[model samples]
Target: MTYCVGMLLDKGMAFMSDTRTNSGVDNISTFRKMFSWSVPGERFITMMTAGNLATTQALISQLEERTKAPSERKPSILEAPTMFQVANIIGTTLRDTIAARALTGPVAASPAPNFNASVIVGGQIAGMEPRLYLIYPEGNFIEASPETPFFQIGETKYGRPILVRGFESHMSFADITKLLMVSFDSTLKANLSVGLPLDLMLYRNDDFAPFHERRITADDPYFEKISDSWSEALRNAFHSLPDYELDA
Candidate 1:
């Protein structure tokens, strides 16, 4: 269980993913679920994954290895001429990795999640418009359109309402980031599996390099402030709403 989001904005794109994984109440761990690749002025790619940790890691590891040594898995994500092609390559790799894991069965003491992994992929390539996609466990994916400017994976229900109500195409990068912080914070409060230390990435249009990227820990001052303020605001909003009166 994890929470990850990718937003496509007028200026660029942004992504956030939590670093929490747990097997049971006693066994909990943190692992990064975000990966990025870029080639200066050529292209930039960022991905956040959720679902079976083993399946997700196997997919990411295979993608990373392909960049170092390309095999029949098609060109590395960095080599893809367009963001669409990059998504295809990633989806294929993910499907293949899960299939292989299924064939091998449970490994010793560790178990994989029977091909249940999904990813949010986004970035831009030189000459192409920025794009965002939600890749499903079956390898099929859908892109963000004007009607849908963002995609969220894993533990999504708790935070989706905020995005649905506040998202806008012309919002500044800062504004969108703040919105996402609120969303993530809300999800974190309601879900135990999705813990803190979130990874954030921002890419400005055509930069081919990230505008900003960082990990937000529980102790981070800004996140702390945002969390506190959002909670208070939500409470106030709830209290301010008009109450219904019953007529006898």
Candidate 2:
């Protein structure tokens, strides 16, 4: 399991993803779940993955190879004229990768392993406005909108409430980063599968490149402060609520 979020903001876009992967309690590792590609002034694309490790890795590998050899691949994300087209290309590639794995892996007599993964992709092209999309395991996707300006994939429930309550379209990048840290901290406390370090990225509108990017390690002082402060705040808030009394 993993946790990843891509948000659309008035200033631009922000993304965060945890780096933990595990087959069992005994087998745990850290692997990057976020990736980005940019062409200086032309375009910028970022992707976050969740679900089967192999499927996600294969999907990312193919996308990377296509970017390096766009002429051979024909329709790479870097060459896609619009963010919508880029989403389409990524969705199609993910669906095809899963299908190919299913067909080539095991015989039909037995149930195949789960080769399913989902992706959150967002970015901007030269003339187009920034866009965000959630691409499913089946290749279908939906774009983020004013009504739904953010996307969260994988182990999402533990960290969703704060985002729903606190996210504001006009919030500054600093505030947004703090909000994401709280969200991730909550998930890390609740689920062992969602361990850190975490990857964070922020893009300013029309910049076509990341404005800020950082990896928050377990010992990072800012993250530690956020976690402790959030916990204390939550406890104080709970205590402040009027206590319930049994009916007479």
Candidate 3:
């Protein structure tokens, strides 16, 4: 399992994903689940993935190949005129990759492996407003809007409450990053499957390039501070609530 979040902010976008994969308690590994591509001054694109590692890796490899050889592959995300079109291309590619993996034997005689994955993609193109999308395993997707301005996939329940209470459309990049850290920290504490070092990316609207990007390792001092501080704050808030009195 993994955990990934892509949030739309007035400033642009923020993405964070954990790097843990496991087949069993005894078998665990770390692998990045976030990727980005750009055409400087024209477009900037970022994606976060959750679900089958094989399917997500294959989908990303195919997209990378298309960018490298657009003339041969066709409909590359870099060449898509709009972010909407880019989402369509990614959705189609992801769906096709899963389907192709299932055709390994006689259709009626063999059962397909679970090649299911989902994506959260967001970015901007020249002349168009920044956009964010949640693409499902089925190849269908929905754009983020005022009513639903963020997307989370994989082990989502453990971290969702922090985002629901803290996110703001007008928040600065610094604040959003802090919010995501707390969210991931909550998940890490609750579930062993969502271990870190986390990958983070921030983009400013219309920049056509990432504003900042980094990895937060287990020993990062700033993250340690955030985790401790949040726990203290939660305890304080709990204590502050009025006590109930019962009739004697």
* Top of the candidates by TM-score: 2
What lDDT tens digits, residue by residue, belong to model 2 across residues 1-248? Answer: 99999999999999999999988888999999999999998999999999999999999999999989957746989888899999999999999999998888866645567889999999999888999999999999999999999999999998999999999989999999999999999999999999989999999989999989999999999999999999899999999999999898
* Order of quality (TM-score): 2, 3, 1
Highest lDDT model number: 2
Model 3 lDDT per residue over 188-245, tens place? 9999999989999999998999989999999999999999999999999999999889
TM-score of 1: 0.93
Worst 10 residues of 3 by lDDT: 104-113
lDDT of 3 at 236: 96
